[model samples]
Target: MTQQPVDDIEIVAALFQLARSGAIYTKEVLLIEAKKLFPDVPEERLLDCRRQLGERLKGSDYLGYSDEYDRQRRRKAS
Candidate 1:
């Protein structure tokens, strides 16, 4: 059986939803699932998507997964 092809937007959306729903926690787990959806996707692309999502989802009532990247930024700014 062939796996369905997923686009970047779809992958990002899935990751966002999963994070918000508490289905995915760390970046490691997110990549594992993202690869399942789009096997040919590169890790760099997924990392980029994760960065974008963290920016978009920060401080917008998303209490599911804390943005560790933003936390690091705060730690550095202090």
Candidate 2:
């Protein structure tokens, strides 16, 4: 069985659906879910799709990290 290549639009749509589910998710969690949905897709490609989606949704109320998660990320960065 051959798996059809998933396109950027499809990836973006899947990510959007997961994001807009009223549940806030950290980047890691979102990426994990995306990977599960697109196991055949490369992680790099998934990351790129996620980046684009985030850029498009910036300043909107669609997908966002919680304040606590943001703080934790910052701490990890330091």
Candidate 3:
């Protein structure tokens, strides 16, 4: 059986939703939520999606997952 392709937009939306909720979250938490949205998608693909989101959203209002702590949070106003 072939796995369906994961939607990058949806994954990014979920990540953004989680990050913008005024709370800190670990990468694990973000993955868990994404998995819930795309249960059949491979874990590797989801991780890649998360990585891409981090890179694209870097320095934006939403802070992506960090390797140093594996946590995500919203950027504060300057």
Candidate 4:
């Protein structure tokens, strides 16, 4: 299936929600939350989405994944 274009705003929102929910017990669950926020996003786009969100949360420090990305994003408003 062709994936839709997912903007940064939705990606940031999903990160915050997943972090706030505090129940992302599994990778699949995290992916589900991502898809919920970005319906057009494909499964493989999760990492890309996370990276996009990281850019907003960490500026150019988006050096891949970090344990702090979600925590920091959750503290900010959507």
Candidate 5:
């Protein structure tokens, strides 16, 4: 059977979906999750997804969202 192909847009879309879920998703987990969504995503595109995800997230206004995810992540790391 032929393996399905993955695309950059799909990977970025998954990142956005995960963020909307309000979970503390890290770069590593996000990559894994993206893999699950698009098993055939190229490693290069996956790397780009990480960069794009960060760019989009860094520009987002956290005003409408709670910091629980952020605080919990910090506490766990600490």
Candidate 6:
């Protein structure tokens, strides 16, 4: 069987899928894995991806998923 070629889009999708499935959790952990997969990506861009993925995974039961904490933090920062 031919293996699918890995790319940035596929990698990001897999990361998000894992989070959605409750396999991988925590935005920090996801960002770390993303950096490992695409070390050349800019830090700011990675953070943006992290934020976007986090938003998409909202309400998931993934380990470390925490909308409440995020909201509380945002309220405190406001």
Give the best candidate by TM-score: 2
Residues 1-78 of candidate 3 have per-residue lDDT tens digits of 986665787777777787778563788888888788788878998898888787767645354335323332233322
Runs in model 2 lying further than 4 Å from the true structure: 59-78
Query: Which portions of model 3 show Cα errors greater than 4 Å?
Result: 1-6, 59-78
In terms of lDDT, model 1 sits at: 0.76
Clashing residue pairs in candidate 6 are none
Superposed on all Cα atoms, the candidates' RMSDs to the truth, in angstroms, are 4.8, 5.5, 8.3, 10.4, 6.1, 6.0
Q: Say which candidate scores most in lDDT.
A: 2
lDDT of 6 by residue, 1-78 (tens): 985555545655767766777756687777777788667778777777666655666656477548677778999999
**Candidate 4, superposed: residue stretches over 4 Å from native:** 1-6, 52-78
Off by over 4 Å in 5: 1-7, 60-78
Q: Rank the candidates by TM-score, best first.
A: 2, 1, 3, 5, 6, 4
- Score candidate 1 by TM-score against the native: 0.61
Decreasing lDDT order of the candidates: 2, 1, 5, 3, 6, 4
Clashes of each: 0, 0, 0, 0, 0, 0
**Model 4, residue 76: displacement in angstroms?**
34
Query: lDDT (0-100) at residue 75 of candidate 2?
Result: 100
Q: Whole-model Cα lDDT per candidate?
A: 0.76, 0.85, 0.72, 0.68, 0.73, 0.69
The sequence of per-residue lDDT tens digits that candidate 2 reaches over residues 1-78 is 987887899999999999889574788889999999999899999999999898777645445555556779899999
TM-score per candidate? 0.61, 0.69, 0.58, 0.44, 0.57, 0.49
lDDT of 5 by residue, 6-75 (tens): 6667678778888678774577777777777666667678879879877776668467343666778899
